[model samples]
Each structure stands twice: as structure tokens, then as C-alpha cells.
Target chain A: MKIAVDAMGGDFAPLEIVLGSIEAIRENPHMEVVLVGDEQQIFTILKENNEQKNPRITVHHASEVIGMDEHPAQALRKKKDASVVVATALVKDKQCDAVIAPGSTGAAVAAALFGLGRIKGIDRPTIATPIPTVNGVTVMLDSGANANSKPKHLVQGALMGSEYAKLLLGKANPTVGLLSIGEEASKGNEVVLATYPFLKKLKTISFYGNVEGRDIPKGTVDVVVCDGFVGNVVLKFAEGLVTAVTQLVKDGIMAGGIFAKLGALLVKPAIKKIGKRLDHTENGGAPLLGVNGVFIICHGSSKAKEIKTAINIAGDLVDRKIIEHIQKTIEVEGAFKYEYDE
Target chain B: MKIAVDAMGGDFAPLEIVLGSIEAIRENPHMEVVLVGDEQQIFTILKENNEQKNPRITVHHASEVIGMDEHPAQALRKKKDASVVVATALVKDKQCDAVIAPGSTGAAVAAALFGLGRIKGIDRPTIATPIPTVNGVTVMLDSGANANSKPKHLVQGALMGSEYAKLLLGKANPTVGLLSIGEEASKGNEVVLATYPFLKKLKTISFYGNVEGRDIPKGTVDVVVCDGFVGNVVLKFAEGLVTAVTQLVKDGIMAGGIFAKLGALLVKPAIKKIGKRLDHTENGGAPLLGVNGVFIICHGSSKAKEIKTAINIAGDLVDRKIIEHIQKTIEVEGAFKYEYDE
Candidate 1:
């Protein structure tokens, strides 16, 4: 299977992306990679590391790269040769099996939506994220993808989240929940209350009623659904907490006395493993589901490790045939549009 | 001032409450205390400590108490002579300056609503809490007091939150923010949208459009307002995160050897201090503002340290006359209310 990487997409861009691509190719001998960006920069990084380019990992040069602050839709239209767009088009055209980018989240989303298109019955594609909880990872959908969502959009989130969970996490019947202020059927704002009965009536997944903010960390539900705003907040808060905490502990050990230093040495590996598990930086990025094809997104600040993870995830998604599985199993009906004045 | 203490409330009640009360009265020489609970249990704890009960700290015993899991309204009616009911009555009858209970939150809300009554113009009382952030403390209101609040309730929350920020935190014009998924004016659920325009027109506080979840810890706004459910979720999530991180850090330190142990000490003080500040336990109890009088609701898990802090908070609220301030300020612009089906 072939994977297209947006080499100029993230903060570390060509350097980290190239290194990760080489590493992923090294890890998975069966996989081939297409690094899309300025050819010279990509080649320079490969040469600097004394790595040889092969048929398994090739460079697909694109002249332009989208800036983080640029309007995603506008940039895609104007900069047709932009690395993210070109990479996505390669996937759409079957030049590659899946597309991967750690660039502007907005640009990546727009590129996938415009190039690869939306999945049938999926009004809006969602970024499905598996959040870490005590029990395991509970899936939350639309993590900073679409800011505003309708009741229909929310329902689509549940369906997409369910499909993603069943296919990726291997949950036979994932329990889908609508993120709300409370569990009561009559509770929450109009949107959550309206979405409850539909979710209750659905036969797709094990529709658990509504889940609150605190429930997310407890890993209460298998799949938690909300608009991108709440999802982003929940995701970032969890990420920040994990990051802040790991740093705190590291700082403690570095500064403590002889005994505390000894204590720190006793369990560094186990703690690092736990830290790795929680870091979104290494989670192979968030996948923008509901698109016509598989598309994985890493954070903009991601380095080599995260890029490699995303590449691995893309290959895994292709191997799992997640897109086909979602299309066949989950059926989203009567999708309504939320026409914001924006 | 006479403060009614729910001696039977909290996880470590009577024992912890007794200990905390002794500390409170000892610290505040002018204050009198009223211990309200089962006479036997109260007396046993007081006698064991022999330090809490002075001429200024008296016990107003009750025969029954409300247990967790029982419906608040039902419990209030059945246990009219319950500790919480009796404690609230002290405030209602002006026998005590305020009623402080580190008990079942639902029970406390029920008692306050039934006994002291909602202040005129305030449709729903807010459990306004001052959260310690990296920047400072941010006063967030409607912290799960009423789950399904309308647009008006958010406004009420803002008013109460603002008043508290000014009166307690000493901010002249507390920057009040409507908690949404984004900082944009057009972000969030329908309720947030409806409340946004109204907040812009608000005259009381310096309204800073909207803020996302991550900003709460950054102390972007002095006062943050949202419906009960969102507020509750935010409050609980923050508390859970702080606790979870602290546990992880402790676990991390315990895992290490001498080298790591030595390092752990470097940041232990700062980490501990941060944890303590983030501890909702150290922040005292949430004040049920917009009630007829000062009513403080400590966490059900309150220990001696928390109780002492809560009592100190109660004394401050009484001295500050927060109720009268809320009434005089927000009472003029009748808070919005939803006509629910239930």
C-alpha cells in the first residue's frame, strides 16, 4: 500500500516528516511512501541522515505549502500545488492508498473534504479521537474539526464514531453517547435533548444516553460525540493536563535530593510508557472520518515520532479497510443542515 | 456572627467538621458557631476534641440527617428536622449569619432553595466557585447548581460571578466571559448563542465575549458564566484533572530509584503548591449566591482542612454581606427563566 505524506504541513515540516517517513518505511517493509513537498528540502534531509531513497519511499514534489492562518478553503483553491492538497489528491486519484498530513488542521480538513470528498450519508466528516481513560481509550468525535454542528451533524458524529470504534478499536457494539450537561433525557440544551431520542431509537451501536464532561476522563462511554468546539476543549484540556503533569514529575526528579532522585530512577520506564500512551503527539494523529477516503491528521507541533505514528496509522487504516467497513455498516439518515449566519 | 455548621456532613464529618470548627473559631475569635446534627454524635466528637465547643461555638442538634443517593427534595421534606434543614433554618431565622454544609450537594441546594429562598430577580442561585489558575483565581458560577439552565440563568450566573469576583477577589471590574467552545461571538450551542448578545449588552461587569475550556486554567477572565451542566462538568473536570495529575506524579516519584529520587525533589515543592492551589478542597466551598443569605456548599468529601477553609469562606461571605450585594446589584434586572415542561 502507498501513503502520501504532507512534508510541508507541520511545524517541523520536511525534516521531521522525512525522518518519520523513512522510519515508518523501516518499520513496515511492505509499505511505500510519497513525500509531498519541496523536493530539494526533502532530499537534503534524507542525505543529511545518510538515508537512501528507494522505490518503496519516493518524493512527490509540490511547490507551495499552506500557512497556518490562511483561510483553508481559499488557500486550497488558490494554491492547487500546495503540499497538503497535492497529497490528498494523490489519495483521491488512487496514486496512494491513504493521505496523511500534520499541517494546518483547517487546510488538511479542507483538502480531504474537497479532494477525497465526503463519505455517503455523512454530511460532515468528523475527526474521531480515542481519548485515554482509566478503563482504556474512549472514542470522542469531531475533536476540533467543525466548530459549529447541527443536531443532524451530531447524529452523524455518533454514527461515524461508532463505525470508527467498531473498526479500529474492535468494539463489537460500541456504546455511543451524546456529550451533554446531564444524563436526563429532558436535560441539556435544545440540541442535546433533540439528539437523545434519535440516538435512543437507533439500532446501530449500543446508544448509551448522554455523557457529561467528567464522564470523558472516567472512560464512561465507548464513544462520546459533540461538536468540534466542546471536543476541542475536552481534547486540549486532557492533553494540557497530561503534558503539564509529565513535565512536573520530570522537573521534580531533576531537582530533588538524593533519595527523591533514587526514587525517580526506580520507575522512570513505566512512567514514560504511561506518558507515551497519553501523548497525542504519538497517537498517530486524529483521523478525519466521514471523508470518502482515509485521512489521518497529526497536530501542527508534532515532530518525527508523531509523523511516523500517523504514517503507521494510515497503513493500518488501509489494511483494515475502515472506510469500506464504515460505509457498509453505519447508515446515517435524514441528515439536516445547520445553516449558521456565518 | 453565628455560623451554623452541619456537624454530620462530609465524609469525615463530626470528626473533621469538629476539628475544622475548632480551628475556625480559634482563628476567628469574634465568630460563634452552631453545630447542627444528631446530639449524641456531635457531643461525642466535640468531647473527644474538647476544643471546638466554646461559649461562642454552640450546638443546635437535630434528630435526623439526609443520606447520599436519596432525592434532595424528598429528603428535605421527610427530614425536616434533618441536620441540613435545621442548619439552613438557622440562617433563615437569622439565628446564624450563614449556613455551611460540606454535605450532599443536591441536599444543600435543596435546603438553600427551600429555607432561605431565591433572592428577588435571581431566577436560579449560582454555586459560584473561585478556582485557582496559573495566572490567579477565576470565579466560575452555576457550577452544577441547576443542570438545565436557560439563557437567563447564564445571565444570572454572570451577575453573581461578577459580584463575587469584585466583592471577594477584589477585582474592580472583573472581566466576565461566557464559556463557549471558542472565543468567537458566534460559537457554542444554541443557549450560548442566545446568551451571547444579551451579555454584550450587560451593564454590570466587563463582559469579554466568549472563552474556551483551556482558558479557564489560564485565568483569562475574572468571572466565567455558563449553565449548570457545563459549569458542573468544567468544575468537576478541572478538579479531577488536578487530582489525577497529583496521583500520577506521586506514582511517578515512587517508581524511581536514587537518581530519579534526587531529581523528584527539585520540583516537589512547586508541584505540591500547584496541586494544593488546584485542590478544590483548599478553595473552600462553593457559595450558593443569589439566595436570601450566605449559604456555602462544601464538597461531600470535605476533610478537616477543607472544612476550616470553608468556614473561613463563610465568615468572609457573611462579613462581605454577599447576599445583600447580589440583591442590590442584580435584583433590578430580573434574571431570565425558562418555562420547562417538567
Candidate 2:
């Protein structure tokens, strides 16, 4: 149940990652944490804090890091000993059950693919993230994993997204939705129209038909599927909007006066909780589903808390055998089709 | 200038419509309002309020009204003297500078097309709405006037949008951005990709390349051109988001104690102004662009303030001869193409 964490992955790499890993190690003594990064840098960070006493947490040093701007494939090829790559390798070698990185998304994906390989029949890996909705959270797949995709790619996304939703959200045959400009199957551009039929034909999940952007926050469906391009826009807009709004709300509350301070005091906890939920920086990690191994990607700017959450998510996902469940579900689908044919 | 008002449109028709009309009459002295609706209902509403003192604002009675659920084309065909249809006729017959409605968007477009006709070279009439952006307001066209469109429709939308921008926002050659998933000409769905090259070939305005969804509020480009379906989604999302956020901000503010009430009082004026500016409700109304006459369609829930603004917009559009300008711009493209072909 050990997790290999890329300590040098995120914007607040060594310090936040170290602190978060220590938190995890403190919480779970049975599981070990392999903190991958430059040894001296991590040690120095621990020394500055004067709280590096954790038997379960060990520093597994890697001298390299994947820069955010570097091309993902090139970086993976060049930086073989990069923290993300090394961490992924640890997962492949069975040294760790799962790997976590809040670093470069592309780099992490490339390393995971190169190290552990893609799941059979999975042509593309998807980054599935839970979007807040009134009905709970809608798990939207390929949030930005691969921007351009064909109709088949979208079907793959739908399948992968369904598995993730069922595993993570504990849904009974998660209601799946195809994200489109309109709800009607006849609507949307060609890609959507084509994908609609494919998704409808798949019997692994309860295909709830098409959903629009407004349907996301409303929690109209458990699993919303789309190509990376539209999914990316919707996800990014939600991120940017929630961020912009949270700031404005905070600003509105703190608008200079004795009354504002008093008012803030009364609603501070509720506001803080809402802020935490909306903070993609905190809920920054996403499972790169469709890959064979358990891989969780955090935001580039993830801090200590988020990195720890990614690790926790990776642990839970591995424990639940999400990828295996996905395989079994696909197998069941094949069986269903074969039996029908017979 | 005399404006023809749809007195029988919207959810709170004849009431809010009449009240908004009164507000508009009070605000603009030089302008006259012709309220077109059910004679009995109009008289009853006005008499109940006892606001029939003004000679400038007169009621042109009609019994027919278009319901929101009815098909736009069907309603337009069946009810020739419906408020929306008659209002459009007012503009067509030169009885009024423009027509305003807070009713069904489809019926407004249908009736406008039936009565006012299309501007030269503009094959189909499109609904153009001014979205308040970070930079300023951007006039986006085909905001769901026609669902399915050709590449030529997009080009025409661009020309009409550009003309509206220049005339409404007073931007000298406002940069026209093709709304796509990405900035690259090739990076888009079918409709967008097919439209890009055609738009690039046109020279009526400054074509600033493709713009993405998240770029809408970021204030990158001035004119965003898209098909009806996509535009509808964008418009609705923007409307929903702004409404949700501003309400959240206000709710956060009002959560304070007694002192918070005082704090609210301090910034109430400024906050009100912000709300007013961001409020699309008071932006007069969406103009059914590409129509030959100065035809305006107000929101479904328009109040007196919005009605006044719609009338003013009509006067300005008519005074500036916006339709003639659009016609000439299209003619310029046509002449160039004709010469090149020869």
C-alpha cells in the first residue's frame, strides 16, 4: 500500500510536498512514503522546519525535474531519472502501489505510459476530474488530457469516465451523459453526433443521453463524457469562474468597515469550507484513467495539502482496483454483446 | 423617433412591458412609444395604474399574442397581427424606427424576418447580442437565430457582427475573432474549420483569428462569430454564470450583522452601479441583426428601463443607417469577388 510521491513535482515542491508526505506518513504508519527529489534540498527543507522525525517517510532522491514548459514526450525521453519518471518506475517495479505527482501533467502522463504502459483496448488515457454539482459531483473525463480527439476517442473517454465515477463516487451503474451543445442526439457538431450513438450503444453504464454546459454544475448526470477539447474548455471555464467568483465574494465580504469584519467573523467557517471546495489548487489532483497503473496528477501549483490528497486518492484507487474494474466492465460488455448475438 | 413595443410578450407581459414603456417614455422625451397588444388588457393595466397622461406613448390594440411554447415559424404564419409580427410590421411600414419585444426569441426573429425582410446580401437574419466583456462590449452574432448554418452564413454573420460592433460600440474595425476551440485555423470542429478559411478570405473587417470559449470574458477580441447552436450555449452559460455569481456576491455581503448593514450602505451605490453595468437586462435588448429595418427584440422579462433603452437603440441605429452600412459592406465584398471572377 506504499505510494511513491514526486516531491519535486509541484510549484511548492520540496516544502509543501515534504510536509504533506509527513502528514500522510503520520496518519498512516502501516504505509511507507517514498519522497522522490534532490536529497539535500528535501533534507534542508525538513531541517528548516525542525520536524523531520518520521520512520515511515523516506527520501528517495532523484536529481532531475520536468519543467512545466518542456515538451512532455521530450522531457520523459531526456530526463529518465526525473522524479516523476523514477516515481512511475517504482510503481512498475512493484515497489509502490501507486504514484502521485502535482507537477507537469504531460510529463506525468508520458512517464506513466512509458513506464507502466496503457491498459489493453484503451487507445487514449483520460484525466477525469469531479465537477461540483447540486446532485453531487459529475465526473467529467479527459478534462484536458488530449485536446483533439475522434469519435472513438470520446467513446473510450465515456467508458473510462464511467469506471472512475463508479469506483470513486460509489454509484450503482453511474448515469453517463454525453456533453453536447444541446441535449438532443441530433444536435452538436459531427464529432458529438457520431459519439452519441457509440456511447448509447455501450451498455456498461446507464447512458442518460446528452447534457449541456449548464447541466454540469446542476449535477444532471454522474458521468459526463466529451472530447478533450470541449471538456477542456468547460473544465477551464469552471476553474477560472470559480476562482474569479471566490475572489469577488471574499472582496465583497471584506469591503472595509467594522460591520464587514463582524460579518466575516460570523460566516468565516462556511466561507472557508466553500473556498476549500472551490480551490482547484487544493482539489488539484486528477486520476489519469485508462492507463494500466494507478496514476494521480495534481495541479502544477499544488501545495502540501493537495499533494497529500493526490496520494490518498491514488491509494484509494489502487485499493479499489479501478483499472481492473474497468477491465472487468469491458469484459462484461463483450459478454453481453456475444450472448445477445448467440 | 417612434418605437413599436410588443405589449403582449413575455411572462409578465402587458404589466412589466407597460411599466417599462412608461419608464422609457419618462426617460426619453423626444421619443414616442406605440404599445401594440390586446386592447382590453392594455387599457386595464394602464387604467389600474392611471398612467395614461402622456400623448407620446399610445396603445395600438391587437387581440393576438404569441406564447413562448409555440413554434416561431408557425406562430408567425398563423398570427399575422400578433404583437411581435405587428411590431415588426411597424418598422417595415416606416410607422416606427424599430420594434421591441420581451417575448419568445424565436418568434421575435421569425416575425422580424417575415415583416422587416433581410438586409442585402445577408441571406438569413441573425440575433446579435452585446456581451459586456473585460475590455468592453463585444457584439456576437447568430446567438441562436438559426440552428444549422453554412460557411457562407458564418461569413455573413461576421460582416453583420462587424457592422453592429462599429455602429454600436464605435470601435473602428473591431477585431473579429472566429469562435473556435483554439486559435489555429485548423483547430476546431467541422463548422468552425470550414468557416475559418471563408472568413479569412473576407476583408470587410480586421480578422484577428480564432478565439476559444474561455477567451469570451478575457477581452481578447471584439467580435466573436459562431453558429446558432454554439452561440446559444455560450449566451446561456454567460447569462447563468453572471446571474449566479453576482447573486452569490450579494448574499455574501448581506450575511453580516448591524455594522455589516452600514458597510453595505457605504458601497450600495457603487455595488448597484456594478450590478447595473453587468446586468444584461438593462442593455435595452438583443437586436435581430441582418434585418432590413431597425428591428430590436427585448428580453422576455424586460421592464420599463429596458424598453426605454431598446427605443433609444432603435433611434440610433436608424439615424446611423446601420442596415445600409451592412449592405454596402457586403456589396464591397461582392464587387471584389465579381471582379476577381471576371
DockQ of candidate 1, scored on C-alphas against the true complex (2 decimals): 0.29
Model 1 residue B62 CA deviation (Å) reads: 4.1
- After superposition on all CA atoms, what RMSD does each candidate show versus the true structure? 4.6, 5.1
TM-score attained by model 2: 0.80
Lowest-sum lDDT 10-residue window in model 1 chain A = A333-342
The fraction of reference A/B contacts recovered in model 1 reads: 0.26
Docking level of model 1: acceptable
- Model 2 interface RMSD over true interface Cα atoms: 4.8
Model 2 Cα lDDT, one tens digit per residue, A1-342: 889999898678878988887777667657688888899988887777664566576778898999876778988788888999999889899988888887777788788888888877676788898875543567888777776567767777788888888877898788988877666676576667777777778878789998876677667789888766566666655554554444444565456455555555655544455455556655548999878799898877888788777777787888899989878876766522321211
- Where does model 2 sit among the CAPRI classes? incorrect
lDDT of 2 at B140: 76
lDDT of 2 by residue, B79-165 (tens): 877888887777788888888878888788888887878877777888888876554677777777876666778888888888888
Chain B TM-score of model 1, please?
A: 0.94
